[model samples]
Target: MHYDGVDYDAGMVIGAELKNGKVSTQIGFSVQTFIVYNPANGKMELMFIIKNGQVFLRTIFIDKGTIEELLIGSVIQSKNYQAGNTGFKIDGETGIAEFNRLVINKDFKIIGDASKIVLDNTGLAVYSTSGGVIKLSRRP
Candidate 1:
């Protein structure tokens, strides 16, 4: 998590895994904004969360190529994540990676042991335990 080759501003990482469990990274962006950037590629992963009078941002940045690759891979793996009412969703705008397909699920988990699941459309597969199904053919 580096931006422009500099250490990521710790405050901008929300819901980021840390020494004290899944704590929200704290950055002062309108008291409700934080941005994540992956140094490897130079793209931006942005996320925002507000809880108990506090707002946090969760995002990641890397090169477009990397993001694209990730998206494609996500599409393929999405299928594996589906299970007994659990599903996922993938928007075309997400990327051309394997997992660009949208997924959907019900009664899913987001933290702890059930964080993310990987699937393989070509080789390996993965996915998340969240709700919804992978939604493709509707994105730009």
Candidate 2:
């Protein structure tokens, strides 16, 4: 992963596969964090997580996602800040991306698999046989 900002630029790539004979399968993925901007406590200005320049894991905080706690990131990104609502409770800690929309299973591994599943990039809902729809934000 690599990052470039006003202060500095950095990136790294570790090419190695996870190996284990103890378990039949293992789960793995690459994680990267950027200091591009700051959100409030329990939040951070989300840059995005993209794989292969197609999908975009968004970082925008919904207004209803906790107005007070979200305003900080908004301000950092030159958005309006409603400082009066500072009493609003924060939802969770920083570095926590909303993965609730992702779908994974024994057969459909999110990482370390070569299977080609339907990935909807047009912000349209794509449903699996089990009827769970994946609705991701459009590419940035």
Candidate 3:
């Protein structure tokens, strides 16, 4: 995963690793794009508001046991494709994974402790603790 100034090999990169806890989504005037974790269901979710002021469900996954064992799928509603599809899976416990961008260029990144996550929605009572970067590449 490569973003800003971080470059992670795609082959060994494991997707977001959310602990079993409720996570929050970023909020702001502009499109609030961030990777969140839902502790209630023990799943990680990517939250984003599109350019047209539309909120859509992006990527979701459940941490299996190891980093490589995690499974995730994306629910995207785009002009080209509008539907939920199974996403790629990481093959290693820890290495480098590509940023699962929501849109074509809107990449979300989180990086820190092996288990340090930022709180998104307070009402949801979600907490995140992991370290990884998300790079959003704007589409032309």
Candidate 4:
């Protein structure tokens, strides 16, 4: 498989990626939690959060054709979806896949050592041999 890379710094590029399936999403405020793994300079951080957002997917996998359907279907059936809190509702059907602007308040995180996450709540957490444990709990 050939992988071309583009680093995105905003949510709008999410849809743009659907067009090419070769992009990354990065935003400052969007990051809720992160962990660092390497300690040499603590440059490796794994993020764990995507809140009030959208999911634009395009995949050609050997197992399941478009994983987008699976993911969207799961979100639709989630308890939060049932509760009417999920931000995204099916807007319309695309010839390739169904599209939705997911705006739920969800969270998760990772850092130097990685971590567990929960969202709609916002906070920051980090685990590193140099820093030990540094965190800021979520707020309503």
Candidate 5:
């Protein structure tokens, strides 16, 4: 799969699982973190995984020095699924942390949804939503 314009080589197949009568494949890899600018949420550093042709957002981190203080220590997880022909959705949440003195608590809720996915065989996946368009292109 592609992320931040880079196409990573397929790592070792970890395993597979049956879901809804279809086997989903899993692969694993490691790389330095990267950032994605979301029109709805600004910039976030993220790590992702792909299974069953679907992309899963595994982690989100904001450095302590970032300007967005409200998002400090925030974490996000999401999964992308095919909606229909040329369409898709990303359903997930961001765990928001509330700090009071020495106490901290996290609250998370469903957060993102992207529709109208246009896939380009030439190595591009375009996601269009009300906020704006996010184009993910593969590396050569």
Candidate 6:
């Protein structure tokens, strides 16, 4: 994935284990930039477990000396689609970051989180709270 002129490889499974019909795993990824003076080194960790037909996802990001975490609730998957919501906390305030729908047909699209609509072809098309509709395309 490429963001902000930096290239990031796909996440990898760091560890995995299965026991008693349950499976747990950890995935990690790194984001890096080329500039030495203005460095941007970020790491992301995702931990998930599957038990009794239920799936939970937790994602944590460490970037530029800051930490952010997202604890996603149960994931419901259908043909070429999945949806879920994650616990979101900012500045000691808490809420849910709802991912109402994610459709992956010929392209990817996500709609939720207080009127936030993100399309794979368009970075952030709508942000209601910010009152702006900015369209950014991924750099090849």
Best by lDDT: 6
Q: Which portions of model 2 miss their true places by more than 4 Å?
A: 1-103, 106-116, 120-126
| Model 4 lDDT-worst window of ten | 95-104
TM-score of 1: 0.16
Q: Write the per-residue lDDT of candidate 4 for residues 4-47, one digit (tens) a residue.
A: 67553422223223336566555444333322344456555333
* lDDT digits (tens) for residues 28-119 of candidate 2: 44434322434766676665555554445455555655344433442131133222211112223342222222335778555422122232
lDDT of 5 at 7: 88
Q: Which of candidates 1 and 6 is the stronger one according to lDDT?
A: 6
Residue 21: error of model 4 in Å? 34
Candidate 6 lDDT score relative to the true structure: 0.43
Clashes of 6: 0
- Best TM-score goes to which candidate? 6
In Å, residue 20's CA in model 3 sits off its true spot by 45
Stronger candidate by lDDT (5 vs 6): 6
- Candidate 1 clashes: the total is 64
Q: In candidate 6, which residue pairs get closer than 3 Å at backbone N, Cα or C atoms, i.e. clash? A: none
Overall lDDT per candidate, in order of appearance: 0.42, 0.39, 0.34, 0.34, 0.42, 0.43
- Overall local distance difference test of candidate 5: 0.42
RMSD of 5: 23.4
Candidate number with the higher lDDT (1 or 2):
1
Better of 2 and 3 by lDDT: 2
> What stretches of model 3 exceed 4 Å from their correct place?
1-36, 46-52, 58-140
Cα error of candidate 6 at position 23, Å: 26
- Per-residue alpha-carbon lDDT of candidate 5 for residues 22-139, written as tens digits (9 for 90 to 100): 9999875543332233455564534555545555575656455656444323332223322342223332242221111121124533234433444344433333344455456676
My TM-score estimates for the predictions, one after another, are 0.16, 0.15, 0.15, 0.17, 0.17, 0.18
Per-candidate count of clashing residue pairs (backbone under 3 Å): 64, 0, 26, 12, 0, 0
Native-structure RMSD, model 2: 22.2
